[model samples]
Target: MKLSIIILAKTDTLSLFQMTLNCIDSFYESEKNIDAEIILIESNKDYEASGFKYPDVVKVIIPSEKFNFHKFLNIGIKAAKGDYIALCNNDLLFKEHWFSEILSLGEDQNDIMSFSPVGKPKINTSNSSFEIGYKVMTHIKGWCIVVKKEIFQKIGLLDETFDFYFADNDYAMTLKSKNIKHALVYRSHVVHLEKQSVDSEVKSKNIPKELLSKYKIPKYLNDNQYSWVFNNEKNLSGFLKFHNKWGSPKLLYRKNKLADILIKGKLGYFNRFFLRLKF
Candidate 1:
């Protein structure tokens, strides 16, 4: 299968850029029939002259003062040259045969709209027999997703108004409206170096920290791979905007664990997560 690997590059650090590309290369190194194009959306205008470069990555420079995640992703989405599109962040690392693993589970379907490979579990459990190594979810995480190009043709590219967050959830809602199902590829997984772009933008560009208050991240997630789960936030602007448009009891509770516990008491459905998630 042909695939277009789209990665968003939004940080000032060149090492991180090269590291992400290296991970991509490793994922592709073992495969021969999988025709794929790797594309990069460089949010920094100066990336062209930054002197740090990769040999084969197709770089599109999108210089924006306030980079809109949906807008930039749409840009890469349009430029991609494969039947399948793989979207990833600049901070992610991958295991070997990542492409093959994702394709193994998704290549034949039209409705399996999205699939993500989760990393290996520290301790294996009873559910280790899951074919893809990860459990299926309603929405593939924004950090990494493999999907058919036709899905976009059906529902349209991401809405640019979302600015920084919930773009995936909004897309998931679109899928829901059409009754599409997404999945998580259990065996195909990667290590996400979490928020390399956001941290750099915050440190270098002075973007506010409160922009991430809408969701809940676990406190136990101290490792780099788990970094995407937590952020330092202290406001509600983002939260209100997000929930106002797409809030549902399930979606809200899934994002904010505290809310689920407070509202559900002993009946919160999220407790099923512990029973279901063996990894």
Candidate 2:
């Protein structure tokens, strides 16, 4: 089956511009013999009109709304013609055999419906190495995900409720709840340049750290990935929407251990009530 990789980029800075180009170039090298199409969802207004061009292999989609993670992905997914779809963040550098390894694992485990490349820590007891170099994980990082197109038909599009953060958490919960399998193929590694575009925005806005502390976001999570917490009031509400749906894990939890506990349901239904009151 062919693969369609959908990348989201906002080229408001030189670093983002360079990263986007590098991301597409590396994918070209990694895809090798696989049949794949690269779809770039650029969040710049009139990018084409502004005379920006990508390689002929890339089909660019400039959406009306600038930057909503789920919205941008859904737009590209609709335009995708491949049998499999990958949602990717612009801040990643694809390694050789990235797509082929995932395809191989998919062929080996037909029961597993979705997959992610490892660039972050493995969370949850559900993560177990099934193959020599790979493990199936429930708690997945949204940075890069490869999914069967049919999975969207079964589970539906990404929940538009999320403005930015916790959408990955929501997706992970949905897959686990339905007993759908999601795997992290360690063999297919990607270098995640965690901060690029969003860091520039944070600096440009000059948001004082004292003000960000009010959101109670963990210091480490205050980076570009979770920077949406300070975007606006609507985006701020996403923090609670996620907790209300799944039990609230401690925002200040020592590590991602809280996520593992919460996903396992060991905390129980009243976990959010008791835990949130304390935080």
TM-score of each: 0.68, 0.73
Measured with C-alpha atoms, the lDDT of residue 231 in candidate 1 is 38
The prediction achieving the highest lDDT against the true structure is 2
Q: What is the C-alpha RMSD of each candidate to the true structure, in Å?
A: 8.9, 6.9
Give a tens-digit lDDT track for model 1, residues 84-198.
8988887777776776876776756544666776654333364742232122232366788878888887668887767665566666555544444566666676777666556
lDDT of 2 by residue, 203-248 (tens): 3333555655566554554468766566654445566677666544
- Deviation from native of the Cα of residue 215 in model 1, angstroms: 18
Off by over 4 Å in 1: 30-32, 63-65, 122-139, 200-235, 248-279
* Lowest lDDT block of 10, candidate 1: 129-138
Native-to-model Cα distance after best TM-score fit, residue 41 in candidate 1, in Å: 0.3
